[model samples]
Target chain A: MKSTLLLGTRKGLVVYRHQNGQWAMQDVHFPGVPVSIAYADERNGVWWACLDHGHWGVKLHRSADRGANWEEVTAPAYPEGAEIKPGEPAHTRYLWAMQQGGRRHPDRLWVGTEPGGLFRSDDGGREFQLVESLWNHPSRENNWFGGGRDHAGIHSVVVDPRDENHVYVGVSCAGVFESVDAGKTWAVRNKGLRADFLPDPEAEVGHDPHLLVASPANPDVMWQQNHCGIFRSVDGGRLWTDISEKDGPASFGFAIAVADDDPDQAWVAPAVSDMHRLAIDRSLCVCRTDDGGKSWKTLRHGLPQGHSFDIVYRHALACSGDGLAFGTTTGNLFFSADRGERWQVINNYLPMVHSVLFVE
Target chain B: MPSVNFTYALKRFFPDLREIDLKAESLSDLLAQLEKKHPGLRAYVLDEQGRLRRHVNIFIDGELIADRDALTDPFRPDSEIYIMQALSGG
Candidate 1:
């Protein structure tokens, strides 16, 4: 079981450690700075902190021995001639996603950034180069737009555990893209996705996937909490199936987590529709699907029932073993021990949580 | 020689940051020299396109620079250059 929870909040990275059957606040890093992503690379025990500095721009930092020491690394940069459009020059506005390569490629790291650029670092994150193949895709110029931000961004990068060369990235307003040859070539995989905002609801591109996760036991089974609803892909990402609950609280949300051993089991934090963006009916609940979204069970025990305005971000919910944790926009953090059966408050006065990850 | 000073907020990242004097003719050239002295400082002041960051301000002798995109602003010898973060917050 992962015993440490890293909460990337607007103010800093708050860490909590579980010991003696109790979770306690362990340490805080980069206090007063907004940590967009707090990630721990389990392969090499290297921890990464992606900082969204208001005045200094985006920055990256890494720590080898946990949070005791950290070293700043060069953040990914768009090339000199790169442009978001004909006249708008492109720069890395935000670092949204970070993932390590397969075990075979130990030093390889992938970083997804705003302006829709995917960067790769071969030297363990000391330097990075833009993956131009995906950036120069034909659909990006006209089809890729922003969802919640001013420009398109890549927020999820899933590296195939079986083959390092195969990768998938989820882009806001651009849909899912698959690369079979180590990001040298790409193909659209939004066959069954629906974008209600577009003229064509089932367009090949322009789908908003809030978060994407693959089942550890069966990587072929992928799940995403999308703007439209919840979706599941049984055959990798070649095709998707809508799995959202019919006229239920699970219809809209941002975060999703799949069980490690069961592809049919997953969890999602439920909120109102996009317009409201609040807990359903002024009550907080987490919906669990044990049979691959065919049915859902609402878990609300130990949660606020009324007068709550908490909403979870895309990366704020995570699952490890039997442990489930999520942080809310209103600075409320909850943890569950028996899957989603019960929840306990971890913290209530932290800053707005951007991401939450369970690290070893 | 022109001496350049930085905002104290940057000291959080660059703890040893201090005033430095270098011989340069233009703001762009002076920034390149400053990058050599302190690595990664130029990125805080200028973006990937070499343009001054939107929220960063550079003043020559207490006057804000005129050119931000091309960085054609000039500075004289023995001039005092101040690089600061713009006032922005809720």
Candidate 2:
């Protein structure tokens, strides 16, 4: 299998292709100082990335030929009636998450953002239309500015593998939403979720599920890590159950990767504090759940003691057939061939890795 | 014509002048005046063809100029003009 791993780095997109059992980096610099996100379609050799252009604002670029040449394609074109306040960049649109539609809707695309909204692209990555239902939802007016990183921003969006119309999105401040009839509508599927960040912990929405991993094996079963804790939901998000216990680690982070073969096997790189997103105590780490959230084990076969390093950022860790791989803010890339049980530093003394993906 | 302070990065270009009070009515005039006073000043902020380099910015009393390529922004003598290098280091 000719698998290519597309990683969005501090500089730009770094492609790690397995060549002769070792990974080689292909540097692709997109405009803008730092490239926050990238979308690569390995099959068609096309890619797109978002760059931060400073006071001039954010921009998105498209690469049609294996990332050799690129062209600019910013969509919604500064929404009409959108206020362009002084000091604001002209094209102030920041593209957070970019997904090149799956098989069901090959021509479709989806994007999530910092202000917690969704934009869809039907013609690949050229033009976009905002998923206005979520942005104009009842809670969004208050939840959009859900206050901080732990509140209402959007980073993860999952379109149903089998049916592209069915979409589920996770908001930074809000809980999770489900739209079986595509993003045309949404229902806050946060029952059994305790939005402790709110004055009331039992609110239906606004619970802040930072990451939602819909099992590729069984879309019905999914896991999440949020401000409150770790949870698992079956019945297509109709209900959820807290899996975190006081005796164990309280799930707090922006990353969760489920094993491809087994829906029960999963991993979450938890941090010690909420403020320090990557801070870890080294007390216990690499939370691995094997019994479908019934039990979890703190895997630490090759991790360091208080000295090895305990912090892991939300975008740092990603998984594929290469077991599990993650990069640290300290500019170190780690790979664990046997799940999160052990780790080996592959690339050291590099820039802070914002994202890493393992392609077979 | 207004007094413009250069950002730290561009200060070395004008060794003797921390602030330059040039006589000009527009951004282009101020830039040309500075170029006349400090020979290589324009080259640092502007490219070979007089286009503003990506890293340079011109501000009028704190707000950045929207058009960096064609910066002919009007200015009054009393109004302060700020010229600086665009922030790059993260």
Candidate 3:
């Protein structure tokens, strides 16, 4: 039972090592930069690395031995006077997500930023602060936007293994947010979801959740992959239900995986929307749902069925143990011990994959 | 008294950095004395509202320094400085 894989790349963090059954490449941590997210807190062994030094900004590294050695901490900034607007200019432009603080906060650590912020760390990941009632909330300047750069950016940080004070976040155009006393306060869970460019496409908070998963057996059940499609929220998120037409009719994708014990199981890798991000006719499948989304199959025996122009992000898929691992933007690397219906590419060159974890 | 240097593509991420020798007289006091001797190199050369970080640039003896937002250039005393990181022109 030795399964480990942590790849957050553009060029760094890589460590795959699934013993005797195959998978190799052992180490390579933050070697060149761009690792937008990487956490390996196997409960407490600690190792969180989120660096995105493109011209320098956003850094946070910490490794208490497991990763051999590393330091640099104080990342999520914006404090001293932090108010902005009078020309506007604050920072934190990267760290898309990193969550590991449950069982009643074992030294908490929850970061998610870009333009959207939410920091928190109680000493385990070293030092972090900025939670500021969901960063001052006040409907954050007309609901938030910038899909990945200039504004909205909280790339999914769901924690609620049955209420560790419960918490959830997911934004990329802003939608899905919750906090049950743990983060001081926050609300707006985007009811049924949708924002066909807004103007009231169910707008409650801009809507654009790209990918968000829960159901590690059932953390009150949640699942989303939106921008205008796939959604499900069984109550923990207040309300939501529109399984993207049960995974077809062009549902788009940015990755999502569940099934830590099957809250009905799930997975998605579709794509061919959001203005053709690729794969779908260029053929590359991976949409599976186990009676939960009502129906969806398309796994494609070992995957990649044609021309292929891969694209998968949103922490690059990932469901551990009995199998599922993903990475691609073209750097390839696949694995599936069956739950994804046969697959195994493992590594093609190793680069451009931003986030994929499974450390068991 | 100025010397400064730093730009071999930022030695991976400031590997000790080089050409130092600063007495400082602006350019934000040699970047606050190069971040009091390089701890994060003033966030790789200014940002988080302190400005100067579009891709970074800080020449002096060879010219380039139009005050990328309050850097206030002016250090001449054997003046050199450099610091660059453009990587490619537009």
Candidate 4:
């Protein structure tokens, strides 16, 4: 089988092809546009790129034939002449994340944006309507403002594989939220999460979740790498249990990956917390948990052992097939085939990688 | 007909829009006509309410436009309009 990797970067989206046991850069899409996220829906043969022009706001583009050609879609926009409630944002800032619906519902798409809003699309990826229920929730003003530039952002969108309507979203600085009825209404799902920065560490909605992923083998079981600590939930995000005690160092990196067939397995890159946010001791180590975060082993074989200052971002680490791959802020890529027990550098240098996704 | 030109920085997004001569009496009119020729260009320069984007600047001839709200600043038929990104992002 052939594998293609899509990397969203600070400058653009880079595509690499792996064949004959070698990897090479295949294409660069949206050369000068800052891509916050790049997603390839292999099931539908469609690609979506979230471009943040900064001066022009964020827009969505669609490519029908992989990444060969592209056309801009009707971007999610707030209606004209809308009355501004005191708390609602005056205008959209940036489109931070996007995730297509489950296998049973291919036509549905969920989008997250800065200023912390959710938008849903029913017609593939052409048009979108704002999820007003989540946007207008009263807690947004107080909870969603710290992680992003000037406002909060939704960086993780996970759709439950077992149920089409059950969805999950992670907001930076605002914690995790779940929508049981297809995004019509939402509730704060941070029961056992912690926000140590706040006066109350157990607040319901102000915690910062860096990344969240559901186990393919068991959708009810999920893992999260948060600003404060690493957490796990077994009952569909109703409650969380901090598991960072076993995760050595500070347990403070941004990326997390889980095995497809083994819900008890997961991978994370640990970094120094507090003022310095780089790899611990300038050494790169990826921690793997075989007993579902109960215990973790640091994987360093074939990886950098000295002077490593890599800060992996959320969405950069992905579990592809039987392999685990992730990129770093220093523009290096690593891949492991035996569940992160060992690693090899696939690409040493590229633009700052925002996302690294594997398409089989 | 007024002469319109964009800074080299915008060439990445608008490849064929380095220079053009068009008939327009005001900046707003020129932007509308420009959008008709190159789709999605207006949204980058103007907001949803048609106000000039905060990070975009327009100068009529050698002077900056005074009316950003309605863009009613009149220009001569042969005036040269210059559009460039605001210096903030740089």
Candidate 5:
């Protein structure tokens, strides 16, 4: 299991290190800044922090030597003459998702942003260029709308470890899109997703997938915590099946994590539906499915029970080996060493954790 | 040459920030000159489309510039250009 946890919070990038059977606060970067995403590129041991400045727009920073020092790099920018709508110009409002290009391309980096744009960097994030193929797709203009944000945003990027050329991005209010030729061309893959908010629930490109993840051992098995419910795809997202609990708290949530070694095993943080974004029954719990979502077991050991309003964000929940961790909107961080059987509170005064990442 | 000033908030990112006088024609030209002096400073003040950032303001002699999109606001040779961040409540 990874020993370090990098937390992107509303206040700053908080890092905690587990040493000698105890976790301690190590360092804080970008003090008093809203770090939307805290990512560690395990391939090259580089740490990245995506900042969402309320007054100065979005920014990106990278640190090669752990957290000792950092260097500001050019954040992805929309090209000139680009527009979100006919009259509204397109600029990078937020950096929601980031992934390193697989082992084949050491210098490649991918970044997904709000207002619906994808960017690629060929030189290890020194500079980034917008991927025009997906941006200029036919359905982006009319079909893609906002879910949680005012404009559509890409929040998930899954790169097939088998082939770096095969890329997948999950967009809010736009469903899933796949690229076979390394982002040169794209196609929608929302065959079974249901967008209940749309006029047509089965629309091809307007589904909201809050977070998408594929099992590391079996790349073909993809799972998403969607706006409607939990969905699973057995054949690389070509088709999806709703596996949400019919009469349980596992029906609605934002974050989901699949075991790296088991495609059939996954966990989800359950909350009340869209109408009420609070902990189900005012109690916090994580639901686990070890048999491919056929059934779910709510794990409440060592978690808050009764009168709790904590709900995890889409990017806050993560799992590595036998360790699992998640941060809540109400500034609580919990970790479990034995899957989701039991959890321990790591902190209680964090500043609305945005993303929680485990790094070796 | 008009003297250019920046908000102290920017000093957090660009620690070397200081008052400087530069020779330029318009607000756009002045910004370009400022960019040369302080790398990556223009992006903090302007968006990708070269428009003034929504929360950032550039005032020429205590008055807000009228042309935010084109940045065509004019200033005298000895004018004091104040680049400030708007006080939107946190």
Candidate 6:
């Protein structure tokens, strides 16, 4: 059996699949405002989700039998009471990005957080230990806290599937950070990127990348939808290039996704600008760039002609082998079976839909 | 001696009183006084060592004093002691 696509929303998580060739909404859990990321491991048969229990805070939940039953999992406390001292204002720690780690001898799970930190879990999704080296890194505070929302503030941790220790983390206000030696040390990779026209230039973290996807086929390659435009790093984020301009249907929201089968044939979810707000307009269309961004094509057929209220959030876009799909901020779900050439509104009723995933 | 103010969450349990403006001195005294009057208010306030537990957040005149070790948080007479359940998660 294949894994199902799980859509984690502000309300909860919903898993759906094509039944009789129809995308059907399955079981959903309203764990308050669930976080952006959700994991379903077919290898070990474990399904886990980090619920962003807003107003209340954040929590981790696990369902071993694929959405059949769920149980509350507390934050696995450090064995010897964490030595983390309060930073100026207060002791506020929150989890942001989470991934089911690669199957190695030790078996590890990784988690990224706000206030900009990372944690690892060895026992599936059970307990976690703060990656001390990354957290205590001299430049971590500068990379993490220096720029707040200007860089979306600490998210998008991409782990190399071939190697568990080899990691690349994206920090807000901090461009691209890579850790070669497990999670011990991290260095900012902002070579070919340009800093904004600010007093503190690096304030916006050169080229403020919004969404990042490492090419599954070639781990050395990664593409990003930045505040400026789209770029790809063939040498694992060392260098970059501009693939868009101030001309045609360009960017605003960081909505980019790569096809799991063909990494080069990826899609860019278009938005309005670098202003960092979701303003919907019918002109917004998902741009597809084949031949690795040498040229592009805009998919605008069968969609709203003018002033459509469908805005895709940074985390609101997803893709499967069958096709690409995204949910609107106005609670409309649409899916396109033919890559990104066309679309159809599959489900029109959701809680101002945050994101949609077409589970296999 | 100053008094303590219960936040909206604490007020949920102690509906009779609006705030815990007690004449007690220490945190234990104030929470004990609230417990004495409101029965389960102490259980909702402190966990064990009179330390503000995970759920409860004690702010003396808007300053958060959740540190557990020294417990040397001082308050002046009529210092507004606000003890509320700080919802954590999400």
DockQ (Cα-based) for each candidate: 0.82, 0.06, 0.23, 0.49, 0.84, 0.09
The most accurate candidate by DockQ is: 5
Comparing to the true complex, what docking class would candidate 1 get?
Answer: high
Off by over 4 Å in 4: A81-89, B18-26, B49-51, B65-79, B87-90
Higher-TM-score candidate of 2 and 5: 5
Quality class of the docking in candidate 2, CAPRI style: incorrect
How many Å off is the CA of A342 in candidate 5? 0.9
Please list the C-alpha lDDT of all candidates, in the order they appear. Answer: 0.92, 0.68, 0.80, 0.82, 0.94, 0.64
Model 5 chain A weakest lDDT span, ten residues long: A191-200
By DockQ, the better pick of 5 and 6 is: 5
- Model 2, runs deviating above 4 Å: A1-3, A42-45, A75-78, A82-93, A147-151, A275-278, A282-284, A308-310, B1-89
In terms of lDDT, model 5 sits at: 0.94
Comparing 1 with 6 on TM-score, the higher-scoring candidate is 1
Residue-level error in angstroms, candidate 3, position A50: 7.2
Kindly list the per-residue Cα lDDT of model 3 for residues A1-360, writing each as its tens digit.
238888889778888888889989999987877797888876777778898877767788888786888888778777755643435676787889888878567888888887788888887766788898887888876677788467888888888877777788998887888888888988898987778988899978888888788898778889887867778887777898887654364277888788788877788888888886888888777888887788888787777777889888878888875789889888898998978888989887877898888875
Model 4 score (lDDT): 0.82
State the TM-score for model 4: 0.92
TM-score for chain A in each prediction: 0.99, 0.88, 0.36, 0.95, 0.99, 0.87
Q: Score chain B of each candidate by TM-score.
A: 0.94, 0.85, 0.29, 0.91, 0.96, 0.78
Each candidate: RMSD to true structure? 1.1, 7.7, 18.4, 2.6, 0.9, 6.4
Fnat across every predicted model, in order? 0.70, 0.00, 0.61, 0.39, 0.73, 0.00
Ranking by lDDT: 5, 1, 4, 3, 2, 6
Question: i-RMS, every candidate?
Answer: 0.6, 10.1, 6.2, 2.0, 0.6, 7.5
Q: In candidate 5, which residue pairs clash? A: none
- Winner of 3 and 6 under lDDT: 3
How high is the lDDT of residue A153 in model 2? 59
